[model samples]
Target: MSAAARAHNPMPVLAGAVLVVMAAQQAIVPVLAPLARDLELPEWSLGLLMTSAAVMFTLTSSPWGRAVDRVGHRTVLLSGLSLGLVGMTGFAIVCQLAVSGVISGELGMALMIGTRSLLFGVAMGAVPTAAMAWVAANTSTTQERVKGLAQIGAVQGLAQALGPASGFVLAFAGFLGPVWAAPAVIAFALVAVAVLLPKGPSRRARAAAAAEAEQAEAAAPSKPLRPWDPRLWPVMLGGFGSFLTLGLVVVCVGFVVQDRLGYEGADAVRMTGLVSTVVGLVMVTMQAFVVPRLGWPPWRMLRSGIPLVALGAAGLMVADTLVLVTACMAVLAVGMGTVGPGYVSAPTLLVGPAEQGRVAGLVQTVTGSTFMIGPLGGSALYGINDWLPFAVGTGICVAGAIFVWTRKGPGETATAPAPQPELAPDPS
Candidate 1:
């Protein structure tokens, strides 16, 4: 196919890839408790495993993204898939050996923790950076790219719903449940990459193509300048706050749901799925219809989302009734759904094509760090009072919103021209 044709198709593939990876990653979170018990590790230590992965993910994102920019998405994505496979295999082996009446106590726990962390790091760090860059490069219009991004989140929600639900079943089946399942997901992803992701054009080749396109478009008038950039600090800060809240909630949602709402173990798990599914659906609805028609400014989304998330914290604090808490969860979902697309789209809109991978990695790393902090912070506060952490979490979200409102940044308004759409067609 021609260069133009290649660019036209890559965006959809990018979105699909992201969804698949997210689904696989989230599938594990719900089952962590069981996995811990089965592996004979303490529940607290299992929590640490989750935190360790986030730290690695945050720290590595920028560097991996930069490398993607230098090399290509194909290389970076494949490397991530490989890491996932290794991690999953490690997990399976550890579980199998442990269940077979081998590797008792701390030794078994250590093995599970270490391998799981490594897998989490690779999965979290690589997927977002590569996928974001891939979409940015392939899509020709900002709206289309945003649509693609929204789809990724939607898929992530779907995955979140499925991962734990399915994982619960798999865990009981045996130690190899998540482990064997992980490889299957990775294999499927590999196929998607092969069929969907276009080979990116190299720098030397792209320069030649741009010169030709410039000559062709010279007679056409320039497009209007987009005012606010999406990459501004406010958007990133807002996203960090949002994810931080999510990480914390994901960690403690079971306890909160059970104690506050009169839910038992399995019931709490189901509720978690319901909340995630609801959020996913809401996000799909908003990004698909509302964002386009209402066309509220990105800042408005940020402002609104923060307060809604705060409401979730409040819901946790009071916990008077199941209905009340459920409403709060929905409110939080709306807030995140409102603001998330803007944040996801910001850096791509701001940076040049060459920097997409690096910037994406950096952003993921930053976001991942929030994931680490949220759980740790929540845990520390949870010790004081069950409600304390949720209360404090709400306060943090409110503060983040305030910062967004007062701050001047990209996505605040449509002042400057938004960055141009980047196009690269592979010769191969």
Candidate 2:
């Protein structure tokens, strides 16, 4: 079907799915320490749950994207949802079993790593890969691509905000209530997607996309852009530094509240929730309402966002009070809100449309690698000293800022940014 004939923008549906998936994933942040204690496992081991997922995503995302390019988004996305449902449900069951002493702590942790982390990780990777590839394939200009990718960033912030709120509310039922609810919500989304989502990219749309790529590549034929391509490296480093810095702070935020602020268990969770909500709200507002209006180029956005991120990191190092921490997190959120669209969409601008799937996978792979290193690394750093993680993070952000400002990545700076369009396209 033509873009004009289409009844809905599938992007919004896809974004909604991401929002749910992320909300479920992030809900565990508030409960990680408590759950670890309850299960008689070392608290640091739980970070493995996240690290495992990141490892799987880093390994599998490229294959997943290639599948989307070969077949279509519907299959890959549905499969992701199905895998996530099964995996997350199994995860909740194991958590319940361990809580009841039906399984040993070691055994429970192992099973959860399998069901929740490893399996779920692979599932999570598929969502953004397909969604971004779909977005990159459809949009013809950099601004359009950034606007589309910013939707992904906005939902992630919304999820970050929502995750802890869900945890706080669900804690009334039981500690496990939020965990159990994740699959149910995911299942509902899966069915909605299976029915409402279009079958795949249509042949006509594909041809139009290819024709567009040809026009864009008239000076030189498009080749599959590799991660190591010199043209892509500056973009990669900027993305890597931003996420790595983020990882250093994110995995430690809850613990900081618990230890430094002398809040225990639910209080710590609530405090952490407040911080996450503040940051999430900031990110959501900035990406959704502000970024599009400004319509800055990807390079410019990256350049502008980095110093703010560094300052946020520096602020986090000194933030002892709950108010101070929340302010620092909001600062970080604003910087990331600026950085994410540029980081995510810049690669699409560097290559022709034919390589959108590959480039999208590469983009996610870089981010996923940070997820692997960030959680475990942050946890370990927090174990040593509360401020060390943020200090390190501050350094990385500064370095990223330096690189982004000094380096000239080809294609991104060469073309003037296209004029901003409507907030979003009306696919209806």
Candidate 3:
């Protein structure tokens, strides 16, 4: 990799943009239930905020990917952050209204859901779609794809480390402090993206890549990558199950720590943040340091990880101490760190450059589907009993992992596949 290639590669700025998006969303998680209680909302309302956004994320993913294909990465990145800033500001206003008694709990929840989840979900969806598409379009081999997707997981892992801690710190200013300040952070990220994200691939470079993709499509007879496609469904199932388990756990963590360990109010929020920090750090260490060196194949990552996840969840069901609980959380994060890159990389190896953006969107859709329903389910089950959600969620992970372990690699087609489209050299 040379300076020129490095100059054109999108991952670095793309990474910063991704960090901002993930951090901002996750920052709200730990305090969400407490804030809802203060505003006199029921337990189910807690999931509504994320669920609404997730629903939109799932619904709009394919279109967002096509928008990137239509408009180019730089344009979409700029616009997405810009919209996110607006949504963030509007969300803050809605929360302030509820906190100050200007709006009723139900109305404020509805307003916040529309403002934050719906608009924000649509806006933030673009960055990851561009990222996955870029990685898919650029990498030719399974090893390279795994490394690239691992890079993504590592960035997200870092965000997870920071986001919860920041929220905990910000909560000192008041419950609404993180909410009010998020827009400014997004505004700053938007500026950085404008300054740092590249204009586009050079005209000649774009023309050559386009021509090569056209040639490959003509030869392969292009079909739009489908979520239900036979070659891809196994990977999708693995991702959906693992992440759904994540959704279940995350939404319940603050409650679990608070109830099981006898923490309350701000202490619960802080303890939840502590649990998040442990998980985040572990994921970062695994994704950044351990994964690239192990050189394991994607399915191995899937099979190896899901069982760990099940074990972790099982521990959570029985563990009474905060220390034990945090240990379980750490084990679960390890599982996430392992499965994530595999889930991200495997499908790209099964397709051509032509389908990268669509695949990216579908991957995002898989993640989105979890948040859409998982949060509400987790919260509801927890309300019934602390351990019930984990029991059910662990069961799901076991089922999904077994499915992956029993099946052969989808990338191992019956016949050797067509050559990958030639891509530009990566940046140094």
Best by lDDT: 3
The TM-score that candidate 2 achieves is 0.84
Better of 1 and 2 by lDDT: 2
Give residue 384's error in model 3 in angstroms.
Answer: 2.7
Best by TM-score: 3
On residues 348-424, what C-alpha lDDT tens digit does candidate 1 reach at each position?
Answer: 65655445444555555556678788876765566567787778778789898788778765665454335444555
Q: Write the per-residue lDDT of candidate 2 for residues 192-241, one digit (tens) a residue.
A: 88998876446666555455444644634446556688768888888788
Off by over 4 Å in 2: 1-9, 69-71, 136-147, 198-224, 352-357, 405-412, 417-428
TM-score for each candidate, following the candidate numbering = 0.77, 0.84, 0.86
- Count of backbone clashes, every candidate in sequence: 18, 0, 2
lDDT by candidate, in order shown: 0.64, 0.77, 0.78
lDDT tens digits, residue span 1-428, model 3? 23443557768888888888888887777777777767877666777777788887777666765665545677777888988898989999988888889989899999888889888988767776666566765676655665676677677789899988888788778767677768888998899988977777565665665666556557663566667898789889888899989888778777777667887766677777778888989888887888778977788889989998888888899888889999999999899889887787787777665675467667776778888888888888888888988999899999987798788867444233335455543311
Residue 37, candidate 3: alpha-carbon lDDT: 68
Model 3, residue 170: distance off in Å is 1.8
Off by over 4 Å in 1: 1-13, 37-44, 69-71, 95-101, 140-154, 168-180, 191-231, 257-271, 320-325, 345-362, 402-413, 419-422, 426-428
